[model samples]
Target: MRTHYRFGHEWQVQARPDAVRALLEDVAGYGAWWPGLRVLADASTPSRRAARLEVRAPLGYRIRFTLTESSVDRHELRALLRGDLEGWCMWRVVATRGGSRVVFAQEVEARSRLLRLASPLLHHRLAGQHAALLGAAADGMRRALADGEGAPGQRVGAP
Candidate 1:
């Protein structure tokens, strides 16, 4: 069974690249805009560039990982993950016709022995859940950007 998953989710928005980058870099602001999403600081992990974030989906499962290396620039926010999952995740922003295109890409391998072993049976379920989560995030961002307030708690965009 394959234990690694590569997910690429893309969307185009009327917002500019900088606007989208700002929203993506504000991980702490995610819960406010993204429905069923929660970002909590992981005090156990230390980082100067950004907070060590533990993200939880509405279903109560937490994505356990720490950013070992990361960088945020005008067009991209990329991070290398380590913990229960090991891999890299990136949010790439680029100018499009009238707005910007945002692509979220992640390549991760299950570090947990049990999860790795169960990949064959559980992979589809895992992918479906992540897709739903990403879809909600995209919808939330679209609303927040449309409202001109993408910051956390600025406006309720929960589904």
Candidate 2:
């Protein structure tokens, strides 16, 4: 029998909540800041509130996901997986005294029986990869903030 699991982590960045949100919305820059993954495609809706992104893992495994139900006021974003894996990935940003706290979580199930059987091993690897990627994002955000590279008028705290 296969089991489903949830993995999540929280990261603190020296950037305001709105700035962090904007940085995330910058699809083109994700590959620059994000550690391992590479963006394959970025399509935004007319409103630009929703987007579809195709990405590949560090090892070059491709995954396409759609981000929908975006709510900036709430500082949260949701994504549905469309390729390779089938599930949901979400990010919730909360404003903090100095900057912001970001929570990243994902719920996924294999699309095939073979993948399901391999989940135990893949889950462990994925968890580690996720942590590293989050760390990289945090580091990149910090560096970008230090250099004042984000949206204009948005000031980030000192590192």
Candidate 3:
């Protein structure tokens, strides 16, 4: 059986909603701000792309997945995943008193033999690792936005 996982995270950034949405909408641009993320194939539109991501925790590995569906509009963003992992991930961005609040959620089934086999015993550990990875990314985002790195005019298509 495949190992299924679900997780959610919320973080606030001191950036405008449009700025945050612009940053998140550009999947190919992730490698510029998000750590350990690499896009393998850039989609012509803002709606889809194929990527390889590696996370280093107590356990480390890489997975290749195609983001077959994506939507980035005024209020939210979402992506459907396939390949080494299969499921859906989404983000909702809202304006807050100080900045923007981003809510992110994801559900996926592990397709790799190693992950699927060890998941029963290490699922919690895996989840923790995922959370930590996201936490780091959030921190990176705060810095990038403050530095005006993810602003408009960045090259966002095809790596």
Most TM-score-accurate candidate: 3
Q: What is the lDDT of residue 153 in candidate 2?
A: 47
Best by lDDT: 3
lDDT (10s digit) by residue, model 3, range 57-113? 546677677775466667888888877778999988888877788889999999878
Show where candidate 3 strays beyond 4 Å: 45-58, 148-159
Worst 10 residues of 3 by lDDT: 150-159
Report the Cα lDDT for residue 112, model 1: 68
TM-score of 2: 0.74
lDDT of 2 by residue, 49-145 (tens): 4445555456455555555434444678776665456777778888777678888888876664545666676777755655766677778777766
Ranking by lDDT: 3, 1, 2
Q: Give the per-residue Cα lDDT of candidate 3 at 151.
A: 34
Q: Candidate 2 has which clashing residue pairs, if any?
A: none
lDDT of 1 by residue, 83-151 (tens): 767899899988887677889999999886766876778788777777988898889888878864433
Measured against the true structure, the TM-scores of the candidates, in listed sequence, are 0.77, 0.74, 0.83
lDDT of each: 0.73, 0.65, 0.74
Each model's Cα RMSD: 5.3, 3.9, 4.8
The clash count for each model shown is 0, 0, 0
